[model samples]
Target chain A: MATPVLTVKGLTKNFGKLCAVNQINLQVNQGEVFGMLGPNGSGKTTTLGMLMGVVNPTAGEFSWFGQPPTHHIRKKIGAVLEHPIFYPYLSGQKNLELNATIKQTDFNNIAKVLDIVELTARRNDAYKTYSLGMKQRLAIASALLNDPTVLILDEPTNGLDPMGIAEIRTIIKRIAADGKTIILASHLLDEVQKVCTHFAILRKGNLVHSGPVDDVGKGEEIVEVIAFHDDLPAHLNQFQGTKEVKKDGQFYLVKMNNGFHSAELNRFLFEKGIVVSHLATQKKSLEKQFLEILAENNTH
Target chain B: MLHLLKIDLKKLTSYRTFWVVCGLYFITLGFTTASGMEFLKWLANKSVEFGATININRIPLYHFPDIWQNVIFVSGFFKLILAFMVVISVTNEFTYRTIRQNIIDGMSRTEFLLSKMLTNVLLSLLSCAMLLIIILITGFIYSPEIIWSEIFTDAGFMFAYFLEMFSFLSYTLMLGLLIQRSGLTIVVLCLSHMLEAIIKANIDDVTPGLIPFFPMESITNLVEMPFARYAFQEIQDYVSLTSVAIALGWLVIFNYISYLKLKKSDL
Candidate 1:
């Protein structure tokens, strides 16, 4: 197995008597896009802040490429936490240049980063002149100026329009494809499910669930079948291995037992002379798993 | 360190408010010098009317020079303005959440503190140089017999003044770190200066000697002459080297406290 690009073990942080981030362990392997899913004030920002060394961890330790939080390790990590704070009066290129200087990066990368963010046309514009989405892109460009081994972003698409979101998503996906480990912290579960291969769910400063996204809601295949008639729910249970059947107007929602296939159920229904208007098979979304985890925590 | 200093300079230079303040300083100095030269002319005329031996040759001695005196006088004004500017320079990083970014960008707390100190020192030196150039030009144009000795003496005064300014800026930087707001620190410094002035007014015997130890007093004494000449038999007795030492001591104490606070505080 390839070495993990980032390793966070038993990370904990406190703001006075209040624990803002409980003991949590996470890892992002080389070239993997890992998502940190959470709601507002769920300690997602705090955890990222600690990883970037902006916030001091009250307990536990983290290592990047098996090295501690030294300058050498930080040089290989790029991050955008919450909002991007730059010199508002300076041009975007100037701001990126300053960051590049601090990281001892090549000056030539400034233009390349601007091109990557599609901000090459507005690189000379002052930061205050840019729109919110443009500012966010510039912020990402600053992070990417060093061509870091790992990229950590906090809500990379928070205030972006759909078009802008697509643009940024494509950029992130491309970066990850280029063999850079990416850690995305966001409240948008759909985006996480679409872009990340691995995920960690945090709630109220605690890590509730974490692992491969494919393994989140294991052992079941959920299929939604819509029929032309509203009485289709009455006959839905005839399908073998059907765990539950629920009626939603003209549709019957079916969840099959572990190892059951949607094709087998469709074939069985067709053989029984029941016409299926619509049959769709899908893994449970990250949203469903996330809500389930939060609900479970509340119950406990 | 040089990279950090360059970033600091770039930030300070980019601020529109900095240029606005500089423009105001130049305009105010111009008005002050014109008015001061008029007053000197009036004094010369009055002396002639009173039948005093007011020779044209000695008029330069009585009047000093144009704008040179204004330049020295403006040091007090610039000291106050620059002190406030220095406070904002350090505090804004905390107020605007840039300090977190700076640290995340790989700067240690010590590096951050040292960068501010170095920036303030460089700016103070730049201000001193501008004031000196203004004085020399004004003095040469208005009075050919300008005393270079007085300029050297003024330089000495400003050296002491720079130390006092350094002390106040360092103390304000610490106060900014502790309070985490530029406005609050300014208010506190303003109120403290006023309170100290009131205290000095009521207790002249001891306050003049003691006030020099406070941050503001040290700055005031550094920019302006000490008033102890009127109350004491010898000027040297009142303006001891201890005052300068005390000012330096304040810088050390405040910087140490700021470092400790920065190391322990949560970002």
Candidate 2:
């Protein structure tokens, strides 16, 4: 694994008496796209704000590249908490230039970042004239101006249309591919699933799960075997590695305990006089894993 | 700090409303100067018909000079208008939620506060310069006999006026930061300006020397008074300087408290 670019330990934030963020621990590795998934007011924004140093933490500490919130380390971080608020009367290029001034970044990089967000053509237009997606893109451009090592985004695709979402996702993926750490906070499960390699599921300000995306749901890979079964075929038992068998309507569901070859299973069943109707592998989605986590928490 | 100042100046100049406000200031100043000049001319003619030996040269001294005095008057009024503009500049970031973004982008709370102060100071200085130029032109046109020395002396007082205006600007900026509402800030500023005016009008009579201590009043005194007033204009000069100091003292206190409040408050 790459070095941890961002480490958030025991992060907590309280708004008045309400605990907006409970003890949440997370980390973003260098060159990894980490996703923070939670519902509205679920402390995603609060957590991001704390990490960005805009919102003070009630408790806990976060470090960037092993350095705490110091001037040198903070310069390496760029963030977009919510909407991209700019001087509405100023053009997009001008807004980015102001951000550059604040960040002490090169003003010439404005066009490059604009082009990265596919907003090069709209650079001269006033910010108020941009569409919702375009505005979000401009915000992303502002964040990228410093070529920051860690880009923290809160709902980067929140209000974007389908096409805009796809575009932003592509841009973010490209940025991550360039070896920069990207931390995205979003409620869109599919967006998290598609874009994030590492995932942190936050619930009520607490981190429910944190690990690689593949390891979120850690059970045996279940392969659904659907066939027109009037009765359980003797050939089904001929399959050697099948762990458990269950009936779903007219189909038989087979859970694989180990690496069971679907082709071998099908061939073995066919040779034993069983007619196969359908067969496919099933993988649990991040949403399903998230809901299961929530269900388990509710039960406890 | 210089970079922050540059960004502020850029943002200030980018606002169309600023240009509109500046235009309004010039129109108001021009009209007030023309009207005041005409009224002085009429007053001079009446004094001559009455055989009171009214001298045109004395008219520039005893009566208000057409250019310098009018510039002072107009700029005083313009300060009230600029108060609203300054409030909008500071509070709009909060109202629009832009400060949050700025902070997240690595701008410290102190830097943000400093940026607004820098912008306010720049605007105040710009207004002061405009007032000076307008008065010089007004004097050159209508009150040619007006003592250039008096105008030059008063011009030096603009630095003091700038400081006073900056104190009020700082106070207003702090209010905007605290309330985070442009409308409320404007209302408070307007009420405060009115209260200061009333206090200034009654200062010599009631307080005996307290009027010059008020923030806006100190700026007015600095602009409207003769240079010799500092040494011989009763105790009012000493009181006025004290007022300017008090205003500046409040500015420091307000800014310090505001810095703490802003540092603690969530953007």
Candidate 3:
């Protein structure tokens, strides 16, 4: 297996009497669009903070590319913690210049970063004059000044409007398409589900569930079928690769095992003389799996 | 280190408030010093109206050797305004949360501290340069036939004045780190000055020797009452080494405390 981009082992953080982040273990792979899913007050930001050296970890340790996290490694990783921070009095271009200086990035990257963030026209404008969305874009531009291999953003769209959120999402997807490793921490499940290739659900400083999003409900396929005949449930159970059939009012939810698809089920039903009037395939989304993860945590 | 200083200075210079305050301070120093002879001319004539021979030409205040001490003393007060500038400079990093951001961008804790110290040193140097300009221009206007060697007479006071300004600014930088808010930091700075004075006064009355050892008293003694030397009062013939040592010591302490605060706290 390839070496993980990040290896977090038994990480923990505490603020006096409050244990803000408990023992958490995680491994992020290179070029993975990893989403740290959590609700408000969860340990998502704290975990990211510990990884970035902002907040001191109370226990355990984490490394980048199999090496301990250090200033050198940090230069290769770009991050935005909490809010988009910049000197308000400085122009957008000057702000990136400062970031470039700190990161020891070449002065040439300034123009390229501004171009990527699409703030070239407003490069000379003071940061205070930019809207929230513009400020966020400039922040992304600053992060890109180092041309980092890994990008970490906490709540990138926390306060954006719908259009602004979409704009940011588009930019993120574009960046992800370039195959850069991304670690996004957000409370918005919809945003995470839409953009993330993998996710880890965090609750009360604990990782309840984590894995590839594709494996959330396994490879099982579910089909909503409404048949002219009344005994569709029995027919579905009798079909090959049908794990179980759940009844939901007039429709039946048929759970298919691996190596099966909705077409195969439809073909089986047709051969069994059960003329299905309506059949619709359903794909399990991260939202459904995330809710289940949270529900599981709450019940415990 | 140079690159870091360059970056920090760029950030500071880009801010409008920085240039405004610094410009106002520089101009205020130049204007006041340039108008010094005018003020003396008025005072001399006023004294003459009372039939007193308080001759401006006879007095050695504006002449060589003494002008250095006199200008340094007057320009030393500029540190108070400059302290507010320093307070704003440091507090801005906290207010905008850029100090932590700068670290996140890749600067080490030591780099950040060094940058601020460098800026303070630069401010003191710039103030000294301004003081030099005012003194040179006025010195030539008042006494053009002086020896070139005498131009820097009592120059030790200028150096002492630089230490005094550096020490005070560091004191305010310490407060900036401690409070991290402009208004509150200034409030605490002013209150501490008043409080130190009050405490020193009571302590001075109760015990004479201890008063000179007070924090503010030690700093204030560095230049040794410039006005009295102009009046030919029995003052110390030169800048006191004890006060210089004490001021430099405070300078170190102030920066040490600031470093500790910056290091210990989560940026």
Candidate 4:
């Protein structure tokens, strides 16, 4: 049973002459890690801002949990948009307490969230003294103060080192495993690919593509093969499953139809008397699909 | 409402700038108002080149029916300190981007505006209470005779003082909302005061009646100068209803504009 956690209809925002977000309609379902993927200025932040009520939409409306959106509605949604916002003079624990106050939640939850973000040791230190990773974790802790059912994080791992990124990703995965509906927005397709069950791509304020992460770049499998023969492309094209074969310097790039395996292509080329020096199957990544979506929209 | 105020209290209590500004306001207001009689005695002891010596001690500066205006008039100058603090506190939300976060965390725009307004009111009430204590002690010590019936006389100035403080702080609040930067908001506040003064000076010769209606002018009029009575000069010895109404009117206008600014903008 996929209950709708959030539903946005024809949401739009315009800053003077610039259309930052335009006619965006989206639905986030329960117990799913939904990723909103877009490059900088593609309106991911703007859209999140509108959903959070910090940005007033020029048109349209959105609802939460099948009810109209309100400030009270937001109490159920924990969010960290753009940067980590807090009183720089306040300690990490005190900052989370402030969030708890606004959410009308228990102050006892502060300790739990701090422990989850692993900032328990330095919870008494002022926010201004915390490093970038610590500040980001404190923001995550603040967002989790209410144990919100819907967590919206924009660029949660932004500007963090590899270790910091892993820590946040681990926390997010743990939270999602608890059956919380999480909306993760990032420009990093790898992050989305690793954590998201469903994803949407936005380009120039328009939602270019949206579907399950598994369906990205469907209907095609790409495998790279290097053969010494100059007629490698011709030989690879003769395979029944081969959709197209293009030459890239010393390698032949083979696009295979659905259900076609690199093993089948290798056997076909081997039987055709063409021994391949190098052969590798390319995994269709969200990065490739994102770029293809952007490129596809660019041509239109 | 209490939750919103509690959130602001949590943010401000741990803020160093808030404490520093508050300390400055108390020290300056205390040093200036609490030393009133000593400063007057020191002025009276000075010798005069003219025939007669100047003595302000004999003027009954803290007498009943006069102490209210005297203390409030002097204390009113330090409203600028409270106004400065208000501007910084309001502008700090923008600088820290906490205002946006507060709303994102589930505060309505009206709640955010009301929270700041409630803080201003709290500060004003506290200031008035402190002044009342000081006035009572100083009045008892300096007054020649304690008249039981007259102690509450002219105490309307306390309400006037509160209105004055709240109105000025509300003005700064509106400016802080208009100009989201602390330094820039303070600069504009001071410059606007100077501009109003310049305009008042120039327009006094033509239309003095309209002067009392100006935002700052009306707030300043709330506590008329009580020193003129020491020179045996007649002063407006009581709080005027007109001035109070004007101050309250400006207060409402400032807050309404601030609320509109908050609602209309994308924080």
- Model 2: per-residue lDDT, tens digit, A1-300? 655888888988988899999988777778788998877888998888888777888899988887778544565687888777888989999999888887888888988998888899889999999999999999888889998988988898887789999999998899888888888989888889898899888888878877888785566656566666555544565578677777776567777666675677778777766677787666778988888887877787
Fraction of native Cα contacts kept in each candidate?
A: 0.45, 0.61, 0.66, 0.92
lDDT of 3 by residue, B138-254 (tens): 887777478989887678887887888888888999999999999999888878768988887777767888776666777778886667866657777478888888878889999
**How many clashes in each candidate?**
0, 1, 0, 0
Instruction: Indicate whether candidate 3 or candidate 4 has the larger DockQ.
Output: 4
Candidate 3, DockQ to 2 decimals?
A: 0.64
Residue pairs in collision within model 2: B213-B243
* lDDT of each residue in A122-193, candidate 3, tens digit only: 999999999999988888888878888899989999789999899889989988998899999998878888
Better-scoring candidate (lDDT), 2 or 4: 4
Candidate 2 or 1, higher DockQ: 2
Cα lDDT of model 2 by residue, B25-57, tens digit:
667755664465566577777777633554444
For residues A173-286, write the lDDT of model 4, one tens digit per residue: 999999999999999899999999999989889888888998876777888998788777788888999999887776788999889989999999999888988999888889
How would the candidate models be sorted by TM-score, starting from the highest?
4, 3, 1, 2
Model 4: residues with Cα > 4 Å off, grouped in runs? A227-230, A258-260, A275-279, B48-55, B205-207
Model 3: how far is A290 from its true place, Å? 0.9
Runs with alpha carbons beyond 4 Å of true place in candidate 1: A1-3, A225-240, A266-278, B26-39, B43-74, B131-155, B198-212, B222-239
| Selected candidate, larger lDDT, 2 vs 3 | 3
Instruction: Assess the local accuracy of residue B148 in candidate 4 as a C-alpha lDDT between 0 and 100.
Output: 86
